[model samples]
Target: MIVAAVDAQNLVDALGLGSIYALMAVGIGLVFGVLRLINFAYGQLIMAGAFTLAYASRANWSTWESIVACFAVVIGLSLVMDLAVFRPLRTQSPATMLVATFAVSFLLQSIALLTVLKVQGQLGMPASTVARLSQAVTIWGVDVRKVTIVSIVAALVALGALALLLGKTTVGLQMRAAATDFTTARLLGISANRVIGFAVLLSGLIAAVVAVLLTARTPYVQSDFALHDMIYVLVGVVVGGIDRLWTATLGGFAIGFASGVIYGALPTDKTAYLPSVLFALVIVVLLVRPAGLFAPRGTSTVERV
Candidate 1:
């Protein structure tokens, strides 16, 4: 039997899978790039959206409505996470921020676990999210789900809009400023707090989209899914390098495609070997280009907004 072969369907799957991975990766990278601390709770943002979608489905809300509402809710959750977990810990150290995020992640996961099924003698969540995808589109006569199409489109549109927002808007200007040198930007009278808050908000929003799309692909939201999948996203960030937003995005897709292809050919028992594959990829890239594959975070030449 042939071990490896290229096909159109394979290409589509890789791209669709890669785009979502990129979406997850860039958001994770954003938190790390600025704060230089891992947001372990990052995946919780996705889980929050999944749970929101699950509940909204019970109301028979349209998919579009549910998605939009989930995004908004998660963004609000991020603001709260920032205020509650991150802000006070700012003066401690990067490790403290990491620990705080991990705590948030665990707490959120516990909430999901305890609510995965109907709570007896209590309110039962009537969520109808068992299936979120319907039809499959054919590319050269190969089947791919419509949700995959929606994911690709939504990711492109959302990410493109964000690119323009960061590149063109005044608030975006401040964000780019804070990312470069938080202390120096603060000296320029730019409210680093606000800028960082905006970044966290963006992270929540992006993670929500990623979560919903991935949830659509799953049978149900499991407590361990977000924490486990998050490592893959973080792998993209590390391999891709987090100096710039685009780097994280591109790196994410590349990592996704690479992982998908490799996983496709591997036996179930061998699946656990992928991380080392990705880690080696990252190590090689860092060795060759420490700043990352894309350009480093741009310097804040413009005055703070």
Candidate 2:
């Protein structure tokens, strides 16, 4: 009975962790699906959303008000990337474009790191959120936060909206045609440029959602990501297969479970190994199935607007 209860608790935490990873992976996958670039700067996007909210809150803006501003800034940022980097890169070779995206990601990271450094002397988590995370409810013997519930809910809603946008809308249809074959999408008069713009916009929106949920759950945003969380996110998507959104989602849960189990079993001193294991898993999965677990089945993702 004790073991069963422990398993149940592990599962709950895993679900929470999975949802967070899924949130990040959704935007990352979407961007790659359309643009074929693995952007390392995605974390900076999350950081931007948090810092934007943090700044707004400090300026006496209401929380929701800050959220609105966050989306606006992220969208503007996306538009800028589209207009500048991606547009210019499109004319270059694939390897060149890939390098350009990496460069852009690095630039964003540098800016984000410096911006946060200037605003806050030390980088860890914000002092404000720790107190906010104190309250929680126990369900199924699991002590879960309202923030986690909210995060999972937001992820589901965002994903549903993405499905509608991709499957039901005319723009989504055009995006589909474009993803499979860009030249044909352009030849068919689908306005590939517009579709690409929308994809970037979508990525920004997803990033925003992830930012909000993650911040809420962490009760604060940390400027430094200690590689483990980063690797965990990568593992979830690669093992689940970026092409299969649901599989990626499921992989997030799987990873979360593995993480919880490992963390629970490990000595506190060696806990850092968790992320390295995740990284190894990701590498192994990449070696075995670079396309991902869901891609072999040819499953396409449909998220609502």
Candidate 3:
């Protein structure tokens, strides 16, 4: 019974992590859908929001106020990235734009590290206020953290709302068209700037939400807080099928869930090999389904919002 209970707890925890990764995948995939450029700096946006939350907590701000600040910082940074980097490089080759994102990512990390060092004389900050959510509640004789439940609910609601927006709203249709073919969409009078801006805005909003949820799970604020998760999520995106948003999201969740399960099953001393084992499995999956594990057979890599 004890072993069964432990397994159930692991499943719940894995579900929560998967939900968070799904949101991240959506954020990354949204920008890719519109720009045809992978924003490698996407994790930096989450880091920024996390730091903002840490700062707010340091200032003794209320939880709601800290959340608002996170949204503001993340969304503002997203727009600035669009205006400063993406807009200017709009006509550049894909390789160039990709390199630009890497540069931006490193730049943001350096900034965070340096700023924190100067202000706090350290590299990490404790978000004690948000960490309270990590407290577990007993359900069905198993303990589940409040943040786990919140993460699952948030992902469901956000994904549902996004579906409605894309299926039933004008701007969402415009985004879909742009994703399908930006050149043709513009020819049809859809505003390229507006569509791209909206994608960035929505991506940033998702990032902010992820920041809050992730910080609740791991309350330490650091420059590389979400860096590794972003890499894993990118892998999931590619593995699940980057061509479609839903497939990409599934990929993210699959990886996160697999990771959680693997971590739980491994002996404590042998856990260091988790990434190697996980990625080796990823290689096998890609070899078997190069188009994407969830992508339909014969499906082309055409972008879908």
Best by lDDT: 3
Q: Candidate 1, residues 1-305: lDDT per residue as tens digits?
A: 11465466666766777878888886876776567667878888887788787777867888788878888888988899989988888878777777788889889887877776554223233335536474587766888887678778977987888889888999888777777787887899988687878788888878888877777766355566666668777767655666567877888888887776666556678878867777788788767766566646543222211
Lowest-scoring 10 consecutive residues by lDDT in candidate 1?
296-305
Candidate 3 Cα outliers beyond 4 Å, as residue runs: 1-6, 301-305
Model 3 earns a TM-score of: 0.96
Arrange candidates by lDDT, descending: 3, 1, 2
Q: What is the C-alpha local distance difference test score of each model? A: 0.74, 0.68, 0.92
Regions more than 4 Å wrong, model 2:
1-6, 124-134, 220-222, 225-230, 244-253, 283-290, 297-305
Better of 1 and 3 by lDDT: 3
Candidate 1 RMSD computed on C-alpha atoms after optimal superposition onto the true structure: 4.6
The clash count for each model shown is 0, 11, 0
* lDDT, candidate 2, 194-238, per-residue tens: 888888888888777766666665645555432345457766776
| Residue 83 displacement (Å), model 1 | 1.0
> In candidate 1, residue 1 scores what lDDT?
14
